[model samples]
Target: MDFARGTKLTIKYNGNVMEVTYISRDEDYLTVKLQNGYNITIPENKIDVLKSSEPQTVKKKRITLKHGNGTPISLITTGGTIVSAIDYETGAVHPSTDIRRIIDRYPYMEEKYTIAVREFDNILSENMQPEMWIKLAGVVKEELGKSHGVVVSHGTDTMSYTASALAFMFESLTGPVIMVGSQRSSDRPSSDSFGNMEGAMAFSSTNVGEICISMHSGTSDNSISLHRGTRTRKMHSTRRDAFRTVSGKPIAEFKNKNVDFLSEYKEKSDKISLSDKIEEAVSMVYFHPGLSGQDLEKLSEGKRAIIIMGTGLGHISQSLFPSVRKIMSMGTKVVMTTQCMAGRVNLNVYSTGRELKKIGVVSAGNMLPEVALTKAMYLLGNYPDEDFESMMNMNMRGEIMEREFLGDCY
Candidate 1:
């Protein structure tokens, strides 16, 4: 392949026209940005070069095919920093669709596992909707049922949110369903994409499950940590390793080309089942100093559960406390989660906490309030008649801690 950065070229396939103005030749994939404003990674071998109209500066392209154990790895694209490539015009990065190219560039990953890369969509994790999750669920069902493990490339901002959603959707999911993303764009030299993907793929081939996050355990390439989706949180804005599992220990680790487990994971089962009936609809609202109750009106139409991302220690103003009471009394189950990224939600710490709890706000206890908000909808959708109190408070797929202190007392 003679393709290089700034080389003007075009590609076509089944109605999808891809023009290459900028090319990032990564170790595993050839990242090309289409003139149409989206980025697609074409494995170097997949380049059906239409033509080179301008001068081309050929950069060395490294492609390798290495295999690990005979694990079937499925890389599902759900839009995230991990799969996005560099933009030549503004230098901004966009969602990527070429997993095979990544695999080829980093042959060490492909050699250890047979990988499948498919793009479901190119939206940031925060932009993800339940309908998208439903679609992703179908894609995951198809892959995990046949593949040894699966990796979902998602945007870091909403990576934890989707992971939490999948944890609730997957009933007894066996094997690893890893969601990997990069806090820093992969265009940067210290980007965490490859390492995160490697960790995720390694875990997917193993027995880890529910939905887990494969990200920098620390701020380096030396190690990657696997935190359960429902338990993990993105704790930084610019750091390569930002996702962390608060209150709970990690599910596993990836270091030095090996998968090590700190805890056991969900295993493969005999009978497989699929359900598409989802009826739950919930919303997440951040509680601010001058918060209004109109947002609760969206949930007020019917029996809706709302999760309020409250201030420190789960405190909401006494003004919203009445609205909280109103929502609870209106048959909408509202839960409370701390805005603090770390520590648990303590409803008994202050009178405000006690007042909200008294008004029937379920304590989310650092469960990444958005996950609680989303899960509420999923369960409500599935079991329309079930009590929201039990479902919201109950530890479904390890989303909630058993008590305030489930670890060392000190």
Candidate 2:
């Protein structure tokens, strides 16, 4: 049977009958929107259509967005689920660069801030690279000159990594730089895009001058969290509250359209200082029980820096010591970070750690593995060789906490 878009239909599937709105159909399956606002694709041979009706013609008015009287805010879109929607004809979600479509969804944004948008890139976060981070830093610098703050829309998969890189690259910021992402696509019923974006905009107007991430504070839509970029990580695969601060508390929380500070944060500064240079010759290795010295050596070959996600208190198999020492002898820097979620690496406590440290394995004090990797990249790219080891252990951009609070761990 043929039906038009928005045609109401009753279908029987697996001994159950339900109503749905016809969206599109292909050779093998039919896609329809359920009452709860989720779209499900049912195999054509599995469902029996009991009744159908003609589509209704409903016109939507075009909303015109104008600059608001408030301070200027710049939005940079780097393609992600936050900027993606379902294509009914294909039943697939794709990235979009239509700034108007996004702004129209939240008209209040233009009503409160003079929003300026720039499409930095239209690629997923997994495709993000160091070169792109350099370019993005430049773009953000330019925008900061004209806007009170900037908001970045990014994919959740690698949002933490990009956020960490930016956190390290910008030594100082004139205004807050907020990175926001959603666990689900914008077209889905349960998408967190709006709340995250709202929180980002709200945070952008604050006196904070740090790189932070704005995401769902919990499963519900009541609150959004503002996490320091270097301390944040994507903890869950598909939950709205996927992103969390690993070893620290969020800087602030946004609820009921109001912002409240939870932790100390940097106030807005007079000028933006950025070190966009990044050494891309960096590799991150997760040490496991059976990883051979040969394998470790092969992975470390020709790399300027390597970040190892080691076991508790930062330990690799004793067998890999030879390879690590050899790598260091060749002028390579190997940094040790804990694979555990919420602890610092203390090389002085364990013989293995002390031995590793003796051979030049720097300890990353409570720094998340991803943050350590990005910090290594930033340090190697801009600093001198003599200062590399010192800078790695320093609490730069809040990546390395002098002490970890017991309550911070979940």
Q: After superposition, how far is residue 260 of candidate 1 from its true place, in Å?
A: 1.5
Give the alpha carbon lDDT tens digit for every residue of 1-410 in model 2: 56776788899989999988888788888889886778898898999999997765434222223566877888888888786666564344555545566568767666688777777876878999989999999999998998899999999999999999999999899999999999986667998998898899899999999999999999999999999999998988999999888767899999988999999998989999999899999999999989999999899998999999999999998989989989999999999998898888999998999999898899988999999999999999999988988999898888877666666454
- Candidate 2 regions off by >4 Å? 1-65, 87-107
Total backbone collisions, model 2: 0
The CA lDDT at 24 in model 1 is 63
Quick one: best TM-score, which candidate? 2
Give lDDT tens digits, candidate 1, residues 1-410. 65545667776645566656655677757666676666766666655667776644333222223366557777787667778775556245555555665766567765567776666776756688777778888888887876777788888887787788788888766567888888776667877888888788788877555788888888779999999888777777878767877776788888998888886556655544545444555677787776666655654556577777888888877866666777777777777888876567889989988888777778877677767767787777777545666777677787776543355221
lDDT of each: 0.72, 0.87
How many residue pairs clash in all the candidates, one count each? 16, 0
Q: Considering every candidate listed, which one attains the maximal lDDT?
A: 2
Please provide TM-scores, in order, for all candidate models, with all chains considered together: 0.76, 0.82
